[model samples]
Target: MNIGIIPMRYAKALFAFAQDKGMEETVYAEMNQLARSFAEHASLKTILDNPVLKSKEKQALICTAAGTQVSDIFVRFIEMVLHHKREKHLQSIALMYQDLYRKARQITIGSLVTATPLSADEENRMRKMLMMDKEGTLEFKATVDPEILGGFIFGIDTYRLDASVATQLKRVKNQFMDKNRKSL
Candidate 1:
């Protein structure tokens, strides 16, 4: 069986279960933290994925690491994963769960990268414009990257809006090369 399939199926099922219980937000955050913990603590993965460890032992280790804020349902979910020997794919399951939760709630997430930080007013205006057409809540984040030279780049899911000076220069350079080649 494909490893990806396991997580996708499990995550979809878990998302549905969480929705039925009206715990989507709580479960999403717990799953996100679980994924982050796995990423940050390599030793946890080593322990959980070790074939020598019993399922109960692995569950204990994971429960200890998952923090007390996680719901009992989430802890049981983890136990199920361990019992089924799918610990290695827990991170992927968490990510897929987050995606499903956001999509179901009609949420849109976007990021903006600019040469410098935006003023409070500018940030507020940009956020309003982005959310204006959105049918649901928007999660917008801003970052500064001087390497963009000037201007900004915004992205949401698969779509990107690039207006950076670097990208403009590249477009001009490509056009110049095309003209030079035609002349030759």
Candidate 2:
């Protein structure tokens, strides 16, 4: 049983179930929070990852710590993971579940790598362009990359539009070589 397969399958199923129950938003938020918590607390994650811990005891401790912050359905999901000794896959499950949420909501997530921090106006303009160009709602996450030199690169899903100065310089260099060859 590959961890990735199990988590992704379960995540899709959970997303479907939550959507049907009209709890998709809430469930998505919960999974996101859980993922963030797991990231912030490495020791807690280590405990969950430990295979020697008895499933029942682990479930009890986790359920207690989770308190009322997570929904009952999510708690049961956690219990099931513990029962199967698959707690280590929780973060993956959460991430997959978020992907499901985004798909269902008609929201597109993208990344923008820029040479410098975008001004508020630039950020808004980019977001507007994405929204107008895309078929659905756009959610852009911007990352600063000093190496880009001057321009920006936008990526939506697997589609990338490279407008960076680095790419521009490469294209210019290629054109120069082409021109030089014609004169030879």
Q: Put down candidate 2 lDDT per residue, 110-137, tens digits, no spaces.
A: 8899988989898898888878766878
Q: Write the per-residue lDDT of candidate 1 for residues 70-164, one digit (tens) a residue.
A: 78778889888887878988878988998898898888888899999999999899888888877988788899999999999999866899999
User: Candidate 2: where is the Cα deviation over 4 Å?
Assistant: 1-4, 36-47, 54-68, 162-184
Q: For every model in order, what is the number of clashing pairs?
A: 0, 0
Q: Model 1, residue 54: displacement in angstroms?
A: 5.0
Q: What's the C-alpha lDDT at position 98 in model 1?
A: 80
Best by TM-score: 1
- At residue 9, candidate 1 shows an lDDT of 97
Q: Clash pairs of candidate 1?
A: none
TM-score of each: 0.79, 0.70
* Lowest lDDT block of 10, candidate 1: 60-69
- Per-model CA lDDT versus the true structure: 0.86, 0.81
